[model samples]
Target: MTASHTPRAKSADTVSALERGLAVLRSFSEDRPQLGHAELVRLTGIPRPTVTRLVATLVGAGMLKPAPVADRFMLGPGVVSLARVFLGSLDVRGVARPYLQSLAEEVGVSTYLAVRDGMEMVIIEACRPRTSMLAARLDVGSRAPLPVSALGRAFLSAVDEPQRQQLIDSLRLQRGPEWDSVAPAMHRAIAEARDLGYCLSLGEFHREINSVSVALIGPSGEVMALNCGGAAFMFTEQRLREELAPRLRTIAQAIAHAIGGHLPALP
Candidate 1:
């Protein structure tokens, strides 16, 4: 879901229940999977009573399940069914499926494929190395902030200048004064992605992790990105620049070619 796909305004026709229900569902993510009732209220900003009702409803529908923790819940098998239906529908994911496993094994790290969804990048695919003991913890359907992630920066670098400006402006408005504080770093990252044909994230999203990424034009004309990431101990700055970046660029190109999409080139 890019900016263009977002509706300009919500009308009276909108359903608040549906919105709140979805918000409740979206509150569950890789980092916060088994949240208690009070935690859900804090995460969703919905009233505790409302959260309780929604949780009960979702549990009845089998979309959520009670966890081992006394009052906590996790996504249920029903959610996996829904995810399977969505993933099975994506031709791009199907095309890149084999390559994802191969690339993850080759790099000995976790890899992800993501696309812009409103103001965030949503991971739609993930692959982990066969023998690596380290867990990257990013899961399909998880969302990350667009301004601070390698995948997001890659998408930003791939978009047209006018659209990029519009996104930056929106970020400024949404973030208020804090936008100014992070703007320089985000701009530097975007420029690095544009110049090197890839983006780097060293302890930006997580303190002990590092990654390299590049974006591709999806078959539907949306921007999509691919990345490889691991613990910082396994990836020095020199190795990320000299080894991982080139491999990431090659992977992006190969995936782009497979999907008949455009690939960015290193300056």
Candidate 2:
């Protein structure tokens, strides 16, 4: 029932090095950046030596760097460089990049490529709109709570029923630090998204940003998602409901088709 145990069981079944490296990277976040060897060991639950080795490797690779005047370390400049490389190499991103760019240009907002990571969605790629005041605001490697994000809900809605149910069950237990409005609102939003073929997050993740997302499924039925977000003041809820949702669905459909997903019948 513990968060660590649940994901550990699932990850152990797969045992991917890439996944482990990501785990290590995710261990360092806003709440706990600049970890020493002992903190890293406890956070990742990996052996101290192994964590040290991984930290060393990451530091050498530029994914991590030693802190200015402390033994603790933080994310290195190499992360952005590697992220650019990773984004450049993804065939899905490459194919969808032009469309996302066009969408950002047309709508004058920011767009993101969201991929599932355990029970969360990570923003792997993003395109900023030139006209928006929030252009280049969200960091590329940012993480979002699945149950609270339009992109995460869109990905969930695209999945098969049984998996969706299981995922929902897990998320039901993993609500954010605050337990009030965010949790109940997400439940309603997801249900609405299931009916509409796209999801919307209106100022839940941020006070001033509104986001709309649609799924981009793969040939093998894997679910990814695309998100478009902007200042809520500039792109009001009414405008998003009327204009952005339809545009997101169209782009998501094209990306899904390019990646070999059957287009879902719109409701």
Q: Model 2: how far is 1 from its true place, Å?
A: 11
Instruction: Write the residue-wise lDDT of candidate 2 on 1-267 in tens digits.
Output: 222312254544586555556667777766576878877766666767877788888899899999975789998898878777877767787777788889899889899888887777878778876677864366566777777778777777777789888887776665545546566777777677778877888877777889988876678766788888898888888888899888888888888778777555557
Candidate 1 per-residue lDDT, tens place, 134-188, comes to 6468878877677888888889999989999998887776567688777787899
- Candidate 1: TM-score? 0.80
Off-target runs (Cα >4 Å) in candidate 1 are 1-9, 133-135, 160-181, 264-267
- For all predictions, the C-alpha RMSD in Å is 4.4, 3.7
Question: Best by TM-score, which number?
Answer: 1
Alpha-carbon deviation at 44 in model 1, angstroms: 2.2
Q: How accurate is candidate 1 locally (lDDT)?
A: 0.80
